[model samples]
Target: MDTCYGTPNRKIVLLTCNVDDMTGEEIGFAREIMMKSGAMEFYTIPVQMKKSRPGFEIRVVSKPGDADNMAALLLKHTSTFGVRMQELSAYALERRSQVIHTPFGDVRRVIGEGYGVLKEKLENDDVCAYAEKAGVDRKTAERQIYALLEAEKQER
Candidate 1:
């Protein structure tokens, strides 16, 4: 998974590939691989090629500090031998917090309150533990957390 790193937390790296015309299925597979490699963004915008033929712009986004990780993934998944990379400075939500209440404990996830929106933040592990201890369905717990987050959004 993509971890947050870099000073000021501008950790988004984009890798672009300009390969020969590729099929939609191939593009989809490439996207899947990119996401699995922890790419935050995987897109293929359509573009006109030579003779007006159709082509795509394959791009993968990762943490700026993860430049090496993104490049390795690009080299492994795409047909291109090299991927162009660029570093960008952006202001993202400072960060979100997850409270890991060990078995049978209550977790009060304090979503970033200063950000544009405020809500409860429950990660997959949180839901799993809640379900395992509370005897609730994992999906149900996920929905519950989503509901809480949504309610908090409305309050903000």
Candidate 2:
């Protein structure tokens, strides 16, 4: 498939660690810090640790160069002593941004092209703003925006 934007050439690094000593609030703070520090994605999975004690497995995906920084952040913010690292080839879809007119106003969307298919995602802030302006529920505003996008797509 032809990319609407230029192809990306880079690798993705995944950093994972298990933390059993930190509280839930610390974990949440770590997640935010990771994102702000350039982590592409961050999440936690609930798990049972030694003696069946509750714990969490934190996962962070980032650019190859940012692995060490993210790992340090994980260790510094969380109680984890060590982090496991892995490198993987990353294939990203070409993406572009466009503003489309909707009943509420103009909204920006991120459109991605991959595998001969095009997909678009509305910005969350835009959806919320539209919902408030239109005095409609969030879902209703989202649906109206999607319908407008679909109609525009069909016109192309």
Candidate 3:
């Protein structure tokens, strides 16, 4: 199976929580729980509640598929009873992953283009191995290798 990342239509869902004001350690702990539950981005927004009491508004951003699990995580960690989830869609990009030959050996790079798309990034270990095998500098090998991928952008 091919390994890939950054898929098109990858929805970014925001999971927000309303909780009582607390210390940094408490907030950070909640943040960690939210992140491990599959949130890609996590943050806390400060808010002033009734009687000038301070609190935090926790927001968790993740893929659309993670909406349910993430919402549950927020509710469980922050003791929030309800959460609001919204869908935001946009065109991503067209990406293609390919393995090409280089003077050094083998290097990997992702080719991405503009709706849902993804490609691969070159692995340093792979490049080094090839460079060693080919008896060439890694930098030179990288330049020669990346040129092929650049040609793809020109084709556009």
Candidate 4:
């Protein structure tokens, strides 16, 4: 486990493998299996392998405790015979969720505090749902939510 100084921290394991023989459908299946097996994040990068063959390098991020399970899943679901593992530490800012009433509806905003400053972002799903419910475009809904948040900020 890796530790951070004076901040909330998490230890994660990164697993990477190069695969040259799996179809797109098979890759999607492997991604689902990895997610179900405790992979926090899974993605692939296109690369050219030996003999000029197009392939992908699959990368999986998992909690330290789930490393073994993730590795096993990768081995079973993908065509990779070997995996590279690395331990990593991450530090996150303090954050909290606040529900605000907007013209569209109630929306949740994530407020993060770091470096003596506050940063905020409106939840994407909430904004999308509000757009659907109000029959407005997504950009319009996003602007409305931002305007609401700005008003609240001024009030504070």
Off by over 4 Å in 2: 1-10, 102-105, 147-156
Residue 53 displacement (Å), model 4: 0.9
Q: How accurate is candidate 1 locally (lDDT)?
A: 0.70
Tens-digit lDDT track of model 3 for 1-156: 543354445557776776665678877887888777778789978888667888878788889988998887777767567788877664456667667765556666677764333445677887778767867798866665677668866989
User: What is the TM-score (0 to 1) of candidate 4?
Assistant: 0.80
Residue 122, model 3: lDDT of 73
Estimate, for each residue in 1-156, the C-alpha lDDT of model 2 and write its tens digit: 555344444589999999778888988999999999999999999999998888899999999989889999988998988999999876677789999888788899999887566788889999999999999999999999988878989999
Would you list the clashing residue pairs of candidate 3? 8-116, 8-117, 93-115, 94-113, 110-120
User: Candidate 4 local accuracy as lDDT?
Assistant: 0.89
The better-scoring model by lDDT among 1 and 4 is 4
Candidate 3 stretches with Cα past 4 Å from truth are: 1-9, 90-156
Which has the higher TM-score value, candidate number 1 or candidate number 2? 2
lDDT of 1 by residue, 7-60 (tens): 343556677876565667877887887788778888887777668777766888
Which structure is stronger by lDDT: 1 or 3?
A: 3
Please give the lDDT score at residue 49 for candidate 3: 64
All candidates: TM-score:
0.56, 0.84, 0.52, 0.80
